[model samples]
Target chain A: MSSDVAVQIDRVGKRYGRHWALRDCTLSLPAGRIIALVGANGAGKTTLLHLAIGLMPPTEGSVSLLGTPLKPGRPQTLSQVGFVAQDHPLYRGFTVAEMLRYCRKTNTRFDQAGAEGRLRDLGIPLNRRTGRLSGGQQAQVALTLALAKQPRLLVLDEPVASLDPLARREFMKTLIAAVAETDVTVLLSSHVVTELERICDHMVLLRGGRVRLAGDIDDLLAGHRVLTGPRVDDAALDGLVTATHGERNSHLLVRQPATAPTHPRWEAHPVNLEELVLAYLEGQD
Target chain B: MLWVTWRQHRAALLTGLFLLAAVTVPTLVSGFAMHEEYRAAGIAACLTDPEARAGCAQLLDQFTAHYGQWGNRMIWVTFLPALIGAFVGAPLLAREFENGTWRFAFTQGVSRTRWLLTQLTVVGAAAAVLALACSVLFTWWRGPLDAMSSPMRTAAFTVSPGLVALTLFALALGLFAGVLLRRTVIAMGLTLAVYLTVRITLEETLRPHYLSPLVRTDAQKAADALPPTAWVVDEGLITTAGNRLSDGDERKILQQVYDGDTVREGGAALERYLAEHGLRHYTEYHPADRYPIMLIIEIGLYLGLAFALFAAAAYLVRRRTS
Candidate 1:
């Protein structure tokens, strides 16, 4: 683990009765970096998120946050880790202003002015109850609360799932700005890799409860490329490693050091965030 | 903190107050039929006028109509205060976790335990007050009816104050349940079942001590008409405490004193005697001596049960998860 890493998991695993939610997962998230965790449905993304949020304990292995062992029933881990849950599970009855006050009263760290400013910036009523707001607005309110906390690490679980594309981008802008202002570490999970690719500096691709890939986005994308063309002999790509292959063209996406491939029989194109994620997941199965 | 709960829960709290107000419907209208019915049953039978008898019967009908459904109403209304508590108090923690707003508190440099406790403090305080207000209203609604007939109120006792306890009970339980369960629906269900089941059982079954302490019945009154010596042969037990212990029952004369023990249960009723030279032995005792003492005993028993359950609930709350 890096000296400045905010969170570290050592072979963590979780289970529900006979079924396993997560198995043998390992990763380290350093401070002041935005990491996007991508996965498919029922892919243990939430189980890992729960661990990061300190809402649950791992059945196997240990998860450390801020250099302390993660524990439940106490919120000590919360000071460093801010969690923004999916769907913004807010009190339906409390107006935005009341919600803000609730936030301030229950949490000494709440910045009233910052929360108010965020609400104002979003054009949401401080007096409007969350239940009465549009889905996008509710998401914004949740994001506002997460931002106002100014935490050391902000953990967002599908935080923008309920927002429209425009609102999502707008919310992400506000979120990025808030994290920038506070220098809070960001670890967000999403199925939409492209959206995360826009603001996130690093990425963790999760498949079958393991870290398929984890590193800086630039380093990861630069090292991998989709090699699609007419069928080429494996001997022709002797220096490259195939990451994924599609049967239709026997297409090979390869990851190699930044070296020029002069073979004309194959096409080498840098993979986009979506293509990288798809290739990773496709390779996992 | 409480203000925030009130701010969010005002509507539900008001609704509860209104429901408590509605509970007075029986007592408020009871007077219309109660006065004459009390006359017909307790004083004299005034069946001469058909309209008057019908009115009295109608009054009696109200009490009997709800006898079977009484227990069920208590269950349905269990959510009355719980709604205020669970929907209001539960969101205290789960909402933070759900919306990610909890980060705001953590970022403020507050320790997580202090923050959770603070929310519990603020929200729990608000819920306790609202629940108490609802309880008081319901208690008052039953007050006049309680004054009307002690027995009916005995059955009525099974509801109002018990419901009040369940209200506070539900709020605290809901807080813990929602935390442990995480999902709102499951938490609400678990809380309602745990709190009200205990409330209902305590009121109707376990604490009531339903089997008669003495087994006295109208048939026993007829059996009391037998001679004291014949009563001794038929009755297995008797009580002569009034003859010895009560000052009023002592009249400086001994009618009969051939008992092995001081007295036995059933035989005591047969020990009655007409005064010889105006002498009295346990014949003129008034039960008023037991009234004030019994009232305190009854209230103590019920409230004691309530207190114990509530304390257990509070202790369990600190263990609540989310």
Candidate 2:
């Protein structure tokens, strides 16, 4: 693994009773890139993010963050990582200022002013109880708390899954600004694929507790093409990830490096990001 | 970490203090009044000297008539520990897990073990201080009543150092319940149920057996009367053959002596009958001086259970996931 790699997992698997939430997951994420972890409802995206932040320990194998072994309940390992859990959980009874002070006290290098300034910029009251704030404001506070840690890596598990479209846009704006301001590597998990392609440079597609496809977005799209040609039951397409037969023609999403089709009767077209992800997911089924 | 713990729980701490004040103020007022009434009625000399007690029965009766209602109200203190356990201790962890905030807390620079310990220590200490204050205040307030009866009386016992241990145990039980149940109201309910069960079981069954009651038997009637303020556990009529006289034997003897008059109609006939039959009364009593020893044993038992529960809570926090 290179020094710029943010997270490394080697043969990691997590089991709950008899079911495997994640199994034999091996992936290395590069630093300073916004990575999207896209998967279906039960596709182990949250489990992988949890393992990276040491929220839960894998039943087998190892996980490392920024080249250091990640062990759950270790202060040193946790100090380098910041996480925003689903629903952006915060103490509902505490004032926003109290929440910020809480972060400052428990973290060694928390930027208290930075967090307060961020909340103030968003017009969130410092003395108001967090429960009274709008959901968007609460999410902003949660994100500010994570950013205040000055972490090397930030892991978010569907932070905007509960937000309105406007709130989602605002949250994404703040996140992109945070990335630009700091040299932090981000791994964001979401089942909503419509909004992610704009901000994410790298993608890891998961299905049923396994990684189906992972690479730079540009490279992944460049390698896959949809070929529409005459239907033939016996015909075989090279580098076929998935194929579908229509009434008069067959559609093939192939993973070949060539940009054009070799047959004269076929048409080749570039694949969009969502089509690419849906193809891989459906193909796996 | 300290600030974070306090910030997160300061409202609860303040609420506890408010409750402490609410209970303590009235107790102090009523206590001073009771003491003045006792001294003015000249009941102190009777309580201090057994001989003067004969002449001061009226005075003691007056004091009891005036203040007995307040004494009965003190029984409410038995539920104070339960309140602390349910509201303060149960929510310590259950609320975090229920609100999904443990993920936020556990990811801080401090480890989960340290975080739990710090919160437990700070909150436990606060509870201890409140418990200690209430214990001392009520003990001082109930001094006159303690003089009237043995300190082993249930009302007086409710305010002893034993109560402090009981509170700690409740707190630990609440924490353990919170971890196991992971819901505030449910854990609170479980804490109350478990604490009451243990307290009632120990008091009813295990307490009297802390030490064997002193037994006295003699053919004379004078030996049957137990010591002043001693707790009478049991009494029975023993025949010369060393067998207990059942109710049938007593009735037959009473019939032979009273000549068709029931024993209740004439108390002297039953006494005369027992004496003539060479039967003696065996009395089992725990003397009042055993108060301190019983206090130690009871407090030790409660503290022991509290520590075990605290260890269980800590273990669960370390091993279980959110």
Candidate 3:
């Protein structure tokens, strides 16, 4: 409900028949910030994105964008929010330029010049049809279309999975630059946490249709550590928050400050987003 | 906005041209040349102009009777458009959704509803144009045949541009199939089934009743045109101006045509046709105005189906994830 809140998810859940796809999951995405959703396969990442974009109604809860509930075909809500699902659905016969032209014609907030300029910078041929492109190129065109919508909240299911490492890096670089320059709030779901580490300040980790951890990236990583010892017991490290435990010299993750006595026994190091996500997922198990 | 729909269906347009050629060539070859003949009285004979020895054959006359043969002409008219539609409509939006281009359209500023409706508009318009072209061509081409093949109504609306409703009907079916199956091959098959099912049902059983009492008759004028006076008295019917042929009377009309007489359908419908056209006691009669009635019903059914299927497809595409 905050004025800066671009996405507000209130206890949303999605189920296909009795099978739970997402459950009791909630997160409020703030404006002008990048939030990354990282999860393994079947972790409910795509479900959360679909719900946020109002493509499907949640079975139990609500998802809203820009202070209004997201409704399919509601002009105002869609005007401020854009979504890109996996596989980059596009009209095959239309060239990249033609697709951009259609968006410009259809959307009130579409930025024709901006989209064209972005595609130009990315070395994507404006006249080439997306169907003829490689998997990576098609993904770029899809991203370019979504970005050009000039939305307040951009929810992408998996924006760069098809890209080669180089194309992926370039896409991320371009996206980060855009996010840095604009007040757009982005929520991108991916399994590759490393690609998001540099730009994302907020993170949400989903597992088994539930949120295992969600908060500011800096704060979550700061208190967490990969504890190592000659023979440290998991029960011995119960007092501190153990994000995950390994078999040998368990990599204990803690959110609490260590006492002077326990300081020498634990090795406190800054956990990167990838390690932090793995730690939390392991801990949940 | 509707023009946007046209840009999307350029492929359908190209495919329609091929269909037009396929339909037109046969009609031209049969109509412009070739005399229809049969063995009769130990010699060759023509169905219509048996007495004529040469110049134009009976086949050419029947072909020349383009306007005269209402049902047969209609068959020709609707077939080409249907063929065109079968080729293009199955792929119009099915290819897009099957290949997953809907993702681009849905995720961008355009709502799924807008994008889908626009596509429908384009395809529907193309159907309308194709139907109109066939109707106009067939109607114009059949000037000579009207007297013998169709005499009750001045107009015979079998498959006109309105029949393009059939194509729109097919397009809607294909699009819905695309959403359900998510593959062009399966979608095309679904569309074919729907087109055949609806078209067959409409054209066959249900359609005869919409306007009530579909009538067809041979173009013959003579004392022989009258069935036995005893047969009429037996059916509790009086002799009107024209001979009536019912949907159940295909064989009767063929017999009456061989006897060189006019055939109508159902005593009541023929009486009405005779009264409406003021063609009392005519040997050959086919009224033309009844054609519009058929076209109207066809158009209504097709549009209704297309809109409904399109709505369903939009719902599926907007909600389902890959």
Candidate 4:
């Protein structure tokens, strides 16, 4: 509805034949913030990212990027959003220099010099064929190309999913450096959450084609806490997300403000990002 | 987009050029020699001068014997369109889907339709140019032989300007299959199969019937009843009762008439017997003057098919998600 909202998806649904990949999905990703989209495999993460970037039309409802309605072949909408698909596909036969030139030709606003400078700094040779590059270098090149477009919203689907730990770290370093240099809103999806906790300010967790939780990282962490007390019925706790019990004690992950009054016999501890994500993922029956 | 298409497909385009050159160089060398021999033998003058008919027959026969097989071998050239469809057109989009480069290419600032249309134009234009060059070269090479036989026949027809449209049809079919099938080898296989089926059907079952054949029936078989360059659909004897004899019946009667007799005496006796029986000779043929109309019809057919295939491919590309 507003320019400050980089991507707005309203009750969007996608169906492949008889199966629904995503349903009733609604989100307003704010501009100029790094938002991490976390979901397990087949959790509709890729489907949602594709809809936001206009890779395909949603079967029902609408998606808008930068206040413009998303359409698959509209150049105006396409120009404002950059996407790096899973595996960072590139023309295997093209030299890195040719790949850069190709990107420059296709985009109206391309930072050719900036991209070359980035590649040079990273020690990626201009004349080397992309197919010959290491997986890490290819990812960097893909990122550089997307950044060169100077898009308002950048959507990445599983950017580092296939990389080794060292390559993953290097790829993230480039991504973080670029984010620091630009005002672009990023919505990157990953099945793994540990690496994203430090860089992402906002988070959206998806489960079974639905959004399980979405909020600012700090508020989400602060709003949910784990409580341990003597064994009690599930109904005894308020705002319970998930509960596990032993004969002598019980632990409950609950959603409430940090300053909420607690029972005298129970102990409250802060939940880490991984624990919070897993609890929600596992809690979904 | 133009640069992108060119850079991506330069390997295939260059390979097409190299193959064209490989075929053209040999055809050109032999074509020049054949034309020289045609001139030196005076076959062109023989074709027109009725007074020289007697000597011309021997000369034409000698010239045909020298180069006739070479012209027939040119039938293989018709396979060029099939190869183009399979190798160039099939891989055009199938490679994108197979390699997952469509994700990268489609998400660029240019719209997907613009990207697809631009690539099609570039590659389609290249195929057209190649087809045109092949047409011009082969048409020139086949000129001496066309003066002997009819250009309406398969050997010459396959290499005419109609080939340009046929090549485009093959290419469009390949592109459509590439998008529909999404696997390079499978699309190629389908393109080749469909192209051959269409071509063979058109040539065998449909071409001769493009227009009705002219039939001539007479009491005696006249020397000029049919032109030398006419495409003879059928020829046989018509019985006194007005029933046309099948080729098999004619062959059996001729064999019975010639049994155990001298060739010269047998011919005279056969004519007398045919007269006594009141059987007439009939010849069905399409005249050489119909060459242009036949070519136009064939070209129109292929061009119309090409247009339909292209439209289908465009629709599929537009509707495709992911």
Q: Rate the local accuracy (lDDT) of all candidates.
A: 0.60, 0.86, 0.65, 0.88
In CAPRI terms, where does candidate 4 land? medium
* TM-score of chain B, candidates 1 onward in order: 0.50, 0.89, 0.58, 0.91
- Give candidate 4's iRMS in Å, 1 decimal: 0.9
Model 4: per-residue Cα lDDT over A1-285, one tens digit each = 224888888999999999899999889888899999998899999999888988889999999888778876688777787889999999999999999999899989999999999999999999999999999999999999999999988989899999999999988888999888678999999976888897898999888898889988999999999998898875456778888888989888999888999988889999889889988888755
Per-candidate TM-scores read 0.66, 0.93, 0.75, 0.94
The root-mean-square deviation over C-alpha atoms between each candidate and the true structure, in angstroms, is 10.9, 2.8, 8.8, 2.6
Candidate 4 chain A, which ten residues in sequence have the lowest lDDT sum?
A1-10
Off by over 4 Å in 1: A1-3, A228-249, A260-269, B18-153, B159-212, B215-220, B223-322
Model 4: lDDT of residue B103: 84
Q: Which stretches of candidate 4 lie above 4 Å from their native place?
A: A1-3, A232-238, B218-224, B235-281
In the range A216-252, model 3's lDDT, one tens digit per residue, is 7887776566666545653455435453445566566
Candidate that would win on lDDT: 4
Model 4, span B128-164: residue lDDT tens: 8988998899999999888878788898889999989
B1-322: candidate 3 lDDT, tens digit per residue: 3545666767668777676777677666554432221122211323244345344344445444543343354565545444544555556556666675655555555666767667766666776677667666665444344433432231344534555566666666766777777777776676667677777777655554555442333332233343211111111111355444344554443454445444545344544544454444322221244445656776787789778887787777666665
- The sequence of per-residue lDDT tens digits that candidate 2 reaches over residues B1-75 is 888888777888898889889988888899999998888877877877877877887887777777867887878
Winner by DockQ between candidate 4 and candidate 3: 4
Q: What lDDT is reached at residue A280 by model 2?
A: 82
Worst 10 residues of 3 chain B by lDDT: B228-237
Error of 1 at A19 (Å): 2.4
Error of 1 at A81 (Å): 3.3
- Residue B106, candidate 2: how far off, in angstroms? 1.1
In candidate 1, position A241 carries an lDDT of: 40
Candidate order, TM-score descending: 4, 2, 3, 1
TM-score for candidate 2, residues paired by index: 0.93
TM score of chain A per candidate: 0.90, 0.95, 0.90, 0.96
